[model samples]
Target: MSAAIFHNPLLNNGPDPWIVKQSDGFYYMMVTAGRHLALRRSRTITGLADEEPKVIWAPSSPGPYSHNLWAPELHEIDGTKYIYYTANDGGGDDTRRVCVLQLSGTDPMQDEWIFKGAVNAEHPGLDGTVLPHKGELYFFYSGYGHFPDYGSAIYAARMANPWTLVGPNVLITAPTADWEKQGGMAINEGPAFLRRFGRIFLIFSASATWSDDYCLGLTSISESADLLDASAWDKHPGPVFAQYPEHGVYAPGHNSFTISPDGQEDWIVYHAYDYSEVDQKRSESRPRSTRVQRFGWTDKGMPDFAKPMALDTPLNRPSGEV
Candidate 1:
């Protein structure tokens, strides 16, 4: 697997990537635009580049969730597949909210997305992720406007049902530390959880989303510890992954992890810019182009994610395949 083969953006103009490994040997991915939910699937991670994504769902009315769709994640729970996403009212920032939709068929490609209505949270939240930990299920999302500073914070709550939180939101991670203070202000968003090696780790994107300094941060609670207790987990002082000075990939954020076809290799899929010359606040040019790279552990067993590969690197198929 040459680096050149893995360098191309898997999906151009796509932002806030959410990925899931289906049982039928394919990877299903979705991201946000203002109007509709775009979806794509492929056998190989790189194969998603050539695959044409479709608008699987869209706003049927001009209401609170009619526009500004962001960070759409697909989850399979109790034999049903659901997509959790963030949306704002009528494409306005003031009405931003989180909602879930149910997919009818077993195959995500069949296009049977049915609106499941909104998931009630204690406050306005975005980037919702459904993760099962231990014998319980939890809903992790980014808290927006709940704090006085208006900075994004990561929160969690037990899920009594797949679409509803059972209690008040528990604050997990915030941007008070120095490492999280880069890019003008400290903002922590995009919460994704992974239970690996008997530890429950929460991976969140940090820094100002529009800046080249945007990157990932991590925190974890031991399997034996109470996840709802903020003091039980430890937060890494630095980023887990971020922009590469030499590669020129900028503002890499809002990512999800997936396993290879053989389930032996880990890959991080996210959105980034091709050049660093563009102004950080330019929304038009900051399209969330998709990219993927191998992820693993360091010598101390913490996550070791290398600099993102250039947009044209060639890589082999995941291990144990052609």
Candidate 2:
């Protein structure tokens, strides 16, 4: 018997890749759709691109939440499913904020998607994600502000509900290191949550997305600690996963975690560029493609995301892939 094999760059032009496996035994994925929200479902991670993405939702009017859509993340809280994504008018970065959409039925493809409105972060931000901890909902986002430099930073605020944010936005992390402050501006965004062995980890991206230096960073706190307490969180000094230029992989960030089909392995889905797109002058226009690879945990309980694999490498498909 032979193992199934797949290649990297699963979908060209796919950026900010996000994948979440539901109880239906299918993987649902969404990326930066630019003008609307869409989802792709597949039985195996690598099979996602084979299915035509279903446009589940789009703005009904030309308003604040009508344009520049990016990074749609699906989450189920309580019993309702919601999609949190970044959007804005044509007004640019300061106008960008997180918006929500609710599913009217179990089937995201068949159900109606209703606009729930913009989250009240009180400050403009992007790449919003939810963390339901200790029976409460907390929202994590990249709030636009000055951390001594004009750019984005990570913030956490308790959500009054799935679509509304309440209380003060607690600063979780900001770009300070040279690596994080590359490509003209500092940034720390695209937050995702992971739990393992009594620790809750927050994985995020740093450095400007257009820069070859863009990469992933991680922070964590004890499962029992006060999640909102800034002091309780420990930030890893360097990027946990970064570019492998020698492998023709660059700017690998905006990642999401999901388990292999049979629940036997952990996989990371993200987007990056090929060697040709390494030119910083034209990097912003270069299309990023979604890629996935399985990862492991360390003896210290930290996720070990090795360097991004080369674009042409043929690797065995995730364990139990259908």
Candidate 3:
């Protein structure tokens, strides 16, 4: 089995794209469609864009989950598929909160997805995601106690179940470094987990997405230790993955992990803007596109994302995929 090497910008444009390869040997993916929730079905990762995405859910009225939906993560827990996303009215940040939508069946594309309500602990935030690690369910997201100065930082809390967070949120990381304070704003968001190389690392997007300086950061935790304690995490001092202007890729952030078809190789799928989109970002009319690349590890057991390659460059296919 061999897989093809796909180019950058897997799709035309979307925010917070995620793909889940299920036991049925198909990939179920969904992106923030703004006005509605649509999912694409593909047998191969490269086939995602060409598939006719199905619209599974949408906001019925002008209330809580009405507009500004951002960073929705789809997961299967206890044989049920669920989606976690940030939503708010057209009002402002104060109204922003994380919400969940649960599917009636195992398959996300065919079953009816019902609104599970807000998952945040009565706060303002977005990009909510949950994972079951070491027999415990934990929710990780970017949020704040107060806006304007509270800014957006990474937070983690224990969850009693998929649709609920059970305790006070712990601040994991915020925009403290100079690189994180780009475009006159400091933000740490889009937290994604990678449990490998003898540690559990939190890989999140840093800085404002609109800025060319937007990049990725890394924080690690011991697999045997308590994840609820904020002090147990170790954030890397700098960006793990960032823009490569010479390659024409900028603002590479908001990433998710997957494996090659044979399940022997690790891959990363993320959204990044090209140099051409930087100017258009002023009005935000143009959108960032998702890209896929194979990443490796250093001798130190850390992930080496290398540089963001140009879209025109050719890359080798993932090993053992066909």
Q: Considering every candidate listed, which one attains the maximal lDDT?
A: 2
TM-score: which candidate is best?
2
Candidate numbers, best lDDT first, in rank order: 2, 3, 1
- Model 2, range 1-322, lDDT digits (tens) per residue? 2558888878987999999988777889999989889999998888897899999988878998889999999888877889999999979788999999999998888899888889999679899999988989999999998456849999999988899878899998889888898888899999988999999999999998888889999999998998889999999999999988789888899999999888889998999888544465455566888999889999988999888999888878988876
Candidate 3 — which residues are off by over 4 angstroms? 1-3, 147-150, 276-285
True-structure RMSD for candidate 2 = 1.7
Superposition-based RMSD of candidate 3 using all C-alpha atoms, in angstroms: 2.2
Candidate 3 residues 106-166, lDDT tens each? Answer: 7778888999889856458888888788778889888865656536898889998888888
RMSD of 1: 2.4
Clashes of each: 16, 0, 5
lDDT of 3: 0.81
Error of 1 at 222 (Å): 0.8
TM-score of each candidate structure, all chains considered together: 0.92, 0.96, 0.94
